[model samples]
Target: MNFKIFPALVLAAAVTLSAPVGLQAQSDDPAAERIPIMRSNGMVLRAAPRASGDEAIAAAQTFVDNFAALPALFEDPAFPGNTQPAAWDNFDAFVGIFDEARQGAEAALAAAQAGDMNGYSAGIQTVAATCSACHGPYRRQ
Candidate 1:
């Protein structure tokens, strides 16, 4: 899974999400259900200090590939899960979390491609930290 396919995946998700909807809440939709799973599974090996460059790059691309559309999914008011009001109150900062994650993943990909496994590992940490960044203020727990 190359990062080149990211834009197309995001575009497709946007198109799918933009379709007409009934009054029902989207909390149970497959996309909503898949978001957390993706986030968890996508980073399962992020903490591995010695994963091969190939493995690291593969993980980075997989994250970018699957996560490109999450912002759109999360933007839906009726999406699943309890979002803290501060997320909407400071929406730009909330969205910045995703931006940071994407940048980190991209940097990881670049680092792995360049045979810099150390930087790739650090970039994975950068990517992982965004979860805490967003969750601190944007997730109800």
Candidate 2:
């Protein structure tokens, strides 16, 4: 097997292994669920560069769905490590950023459906920037 494909295969395996199974009860902590979702998002983003039009559209749609759900997850009282008053403030700001990213992902999905590769690229860039902006201040190192 080509070494170039090896790492991708490993990553795919890791993601598959880490994903929550339907038979297993997930943690009540939002962070526990969020970690795997974020890892899957990274996988989709990484694959987007090489994906075909249909694949890109599917990936973008998944991103849109995931980001749309993020605000509720972040706002959940059971979300881990968000007990402080300032954390709520930070979460509010992060929600705005997440909304922006969701919009970007939606745009990417539209662009893919419309066969506009350039628009899709730009949308992906916007989404990436939004993620980085939120992570810079909020994500635990």
Candidate 3:
């Protein structure tokens, strides 16, 4: 018997027995109930910033990604279990910031495609504004 498989089998049995009808697994389920606002922010930063080659645009993208990835430093199960992070508690606080970030990303991508460095710069700044807006509230010291 494969020892590696044993853990999976046990986990499955535990899930089958303990899980409620509507309850979902966080890791296995594709539509797991993550904070959508946070996800959108991440997408905006990662996808939109790459749309341009301008230094400021790239810097803005890098800032958001680096900051957002910080939460995973605590939340990722691969890390040792620790206290819950603030992001988990303040999911709604950053929704507006993410919305703005999304728009900026869209604009940047469009500008980058059009070879409009000015547009790209403006879009990246817009995205950075969003990230900064949210960070002002929930970001830690």
Candidate 4:
């Protein structure tokens, strides 16, 4: 057999053999559904800094709403790479952080509605801290 043709044939065979495994691995990843939610959450976070008055209130409300659902999402058995039993040791704590974030967001919303920039700034800070606290311990770097 010609060497060039032989290499091409071997490459094709290898790809065909690995295709199912690759597909299966992709299917096994549980983050696919969660990525969009994360992106939406990011959009709300990004908007918060630029928004003021009603816009800020709206953004904060959106942030609170998204985080409110996180506990249920995180509790899902199919939550991305959350397969290891040890990963769930602090599951309740992780969920609790979202509650804290929701409260922060609510405070931000109230401050925005009242046109209190100082309070809004403080509320935003609280929300950010909550995110950092949870991510530091639970999220993959």
Model 1: per-residue Cα lDDT at residue 130: 78
**Candidate 3 total steric clashes:** 0
Best by lDDT: 2
The TM-score obtained by model 4 is: 0.68
Could you tell me which 10 consecutive residues in candidate 3 have the lowest summed lDDT? 21-30
For model 4, the run of ten residues with the poorest summed lDDT? 18-27
Which candidate has the top score in TM-score? 2
Better of 1 and 2 by TM-score: 2
In model 4, what is the error at residue 68, expressed in angstroms? 1.0
lDDT of 2 by residue, 1-141 (tens): 999999999987875565433113344667556765677678888987666589889788778877865665566555655233444667667688888998999999999999999888888888888866877677765
lDDT of 4: 0.68
| Model 3 whole-model lDDT (C-alpha atoms) | 0.51
Residue 108 displacement in candidate 2 (angstroms):
0.4
lDDT of each: 0.66, 0.73, 0.51, 0.68
Residue-by-residue lDDT tens digits, candidate 1, 91-131: 77877788888788888888888998888888788877877
Could you arrange the candidates by TM-score from highest to lowest? 2, 4, 1, 3
Write model 3 residue lDDT over 12-131, tens digit each, in one string.
687445323222324442223233434544655565545546543544444344333333333343332222344456544444455566567667656665678788878777866765
Q: Write the per-residue lDDT of candidate 4 for residues 1-141, one digit (tens) a residue.
A: 788799899986874453233223234443554455566666777777778888888778766766665555555555645234434786777677788888998899889989998888788888878866876777776
Q: How many clashing pairs in candidate 1?
A: 0
